[model samples]
Target: MTLDIGTQHRDASVSGPSSDLSPSPPSSPGLVSTHAAAVSPAPARKPTTASNAASTSAILSWSDEKVKSCSSLRARKDLRRNLEVDVLQNIQKALRTSPNPFFNDPGAAAQEALRQAQIYKAWIQDQEGSSLEVAIVNDHPQGPADGCPPYDFVWVNGYVHDDTIPPSDPSELQGCDCEDDACNPATCKCFQKAVRFDTLNIYKESKQFAYNADGTLQDMMVPTYPIFECNSKCGCSSACTNRVVQKGRRVEIEFFKHQHYGWGVRARHRIKRHTFIGIYSGELVSDAEADRRAIVYEDVGSTYHFTIDPHPIKLETMRKRLASSPEGRTMTEEQLMQRVNDWTRLMDLYQAHREHKVTAKQLKEFNDRQIVEAKRKGEWSRRWQAELEAELAEWEARYREEPDNYLSLEPEDQARAEDLSLFYEDQQEANELTVDGALHGNFTRFFNHSCDPNLATWPVWIEEGSIWRPFFCFFALRNIEAGDELNFSYTSAEEVDDMVKRLNQIQVEQGTKPGTKRMKCLCGASNCRGFVFG
Candidate 1:
């Protein structure tokens, strides 16, 4: 699925650090901080663009009274901390002190649990608002019945909500068209509301938010979150968008936009290696169902494995099987096994016939066979014989190098292989079809095909419960600047920059001069790796 949050409207003047926003001294680039803009001097002029009208509104409203209010806000650091602590404490009480009794019991424990949940929910709202006045609306069972219902409880920045619900069209967050004193809703319809829910949402969704059996909160959780978005949505008011979902104690996937076709995602925020973005959800099929769908394959080792098609399989038969029954009752395990046996036997028979035919021709060759007809036959036989010998040699080498790679196992082992392969195949199929399952749902997908990339992808696995949960993270292997199309090496595992040298080795073997290895990169980083590594 693709999430195209076109035209994210950050104040160009208010981004980054306070120092960065100010004009820099002759010796260095300017540094600015969005957070520290509180004390900065007012600009001589105002931003007049429609997109910037919101900032201008805030600026125009700024007065000595407001400045005093800002000072009061700056002084209230402990309030934020207290809100966070209250959330933590409530979560701890829910896990430890609360009893898991039936709702029939209206005891103190159950009441207490409800109370704690309300408190925690309240904390979520405070986090969303940063101040207490604004409220984040979570789905309350009776709201828009079709969309993601629960809004962040907190009202911090980065919070998103559909202002127009069931009775209205999805609102396209728009800009303020103020130029020439005009209010053009066509050009400036900022509809979807977003508040800063990133830090709080990440906090709540992270494993750190989970309570221990004794009802204590984990103290080691990091509160910062990476959230970014584009500046505009181009013309399409309805394009796909994505979010990082936190499930249970561990952050797995919150599904991206499940509706829409050809959806893809790019990072609004810079994500680091090993971050758990999300998961693939689909119909889980049994081995028999997989075989009936024609997704089964037998390898050289005679190991049966299932594979979902590398591409979407549009076959009507497969579609019927998936649609007809939840458990796929149409094909039985016995029938699937019978089909597998028949297919394997037929394949073996064909192999034997070909081998015998080639062997017979090879044995007919003789030194005295020099007649025109004989020579022609001999040449043909020799070619087949040579091919057969090469195959035999390859098999022999494989057998000697890794004899155990092939398995000769009992019926149960075969069944296990069939089951394992089917599960894998099913997952692959879901990945291709599911909106958020595609790897392209993140910025890492656009990373150009470079033998050596300036970016690198790393797999993150949080080991727990005898399972290693896997997620992918991307990092800048080399410094990147704004506006540079990010690039990463095509080869997996190696960082992009390292892949460059590896590519040179291949080029060297092919006897080509990999000339002028470095060029100024378009990425506006101060420390860009000068060379492009495709």
Candidate 2:
């Protein structure tokens, strides 16, 4: 995916990265850096197929990059194991009609796959470091050429302090339940530092999977959002005043949003505008950990880096058809069947097919097969293709039905939901933002990015599920039309001068102030902010 680097939409919410030589002030309690909150995870969900030995090796090498740097080592192992199981499952399913099942032997396939995985890991460690992270694995045969594998790897730098040292070898580090004090390495003062690599490298070894040219992992592109940490007690309402707590951390800083801008809670249902979403709940995993626990969703026949929502579309097509039918209640079975057939046929016609031609040899083989055999093969292929196409169409339709509401169901949605919900609940309870963990305000998701915006961010405290939390609350600068794309200033309204400075810097970057990209602003508002916020 192409990043809109030149536009304000990309940098609006989060502050730009601080210079390496100077660190920003320590974030106030109840607030954290936006840069720490939003992360574009590695892409391990997508896979590809290979036909020859070289292609298979390329696919394995490609997938290795994506699986290596997952948060936890355990997760990465599990993911690789799961991938092997998926291959075994497909092999077994394929063997159902074979005279012998040697090729379908799970144990044999697993052994071979595992050996390959170990070798791949060794190769990566030799080129990169001892620890690596995998972000994406491309396994399709029709992907890009130029020796790119189907996966990308993110390498993590491990730091060890002089005063205290972790295990001489990470492999010897005993696993402890995070819930226990033993898991708190902080107690031991053991200096173990791990840092993620910034550069993305694809193996490009095979066309089947998404991989870089050098057997490294490519970044799973993520939509960036400006995140704000509440620095002091705040609320969407102006009447609310800042106050330091009598005890505990003083609540400060609020992220920005839109719903609370004008009507506040009156503008929405179920959740109030700027209300808390949910807290992060998944296991903390790096590339290695994620790969280790990577359990392939058994039903899907592949490894899914993120949680899979098994909820089927359960399409309402039948109901829609029934509603449109005339004299529907009194229709005969044949009539109903005819309607169903017509709809099915129409759907089939609309489905996209690979224009690539089939081989004459394959076609001839099909003709030579027994009638029953040929029919079974044809039915299997047709049904398989149809189901895949149908699911894709349903997903697309869902996105169209309500882009904001439905897009949240994508893989990244679960993580964002937890972050937003946690921010709100924490505020209501403790009257502060979460300071110890990452916080995310996915406003760009629903609000849409704008060079100009009509809302400002405010921090609020809320309680949820018996915990106090902080949230970045959005307030309106003006009464907005119902359908106008909701936008909030990425910079704080309280700090207008700084905002102008930031905007000026962006203009300079884009050559608008001095350089020369010279793209016209698309924000139609009369008072569109001239530049995107970082």
Angstrom error of the Cα, residue 520, model 1: value is: 20
Task: Estimate, for each residue in 303-339, the C-alpha lDDT of model 2 and write its tens digit.
Answer: 2121111101001223234546576567754455455
Minimum summed lDDT over a 10-residue window in model 2 is located at 189-198
Name the best candidate (by lDDT).
Answer: 1
Global lDDT scores for all candidate models = 0.25, 0.25
lDDT of 1: 0.25
Q: Which 10 residues in a row give candidate 1 its minimum summed lDDT?
A: 295-304
Candidate 1 C-alpha lDDT tens digits along 92-178: 433343444442233433333333334433443333322222111111111111112111111222111111111112242233223
lDDT of 2 at 526: 69
lDDT of 2 at 88: 33
Q: What are the TM-scores, per candidate, against the unseen true structure?
A: 0.22, 0.21
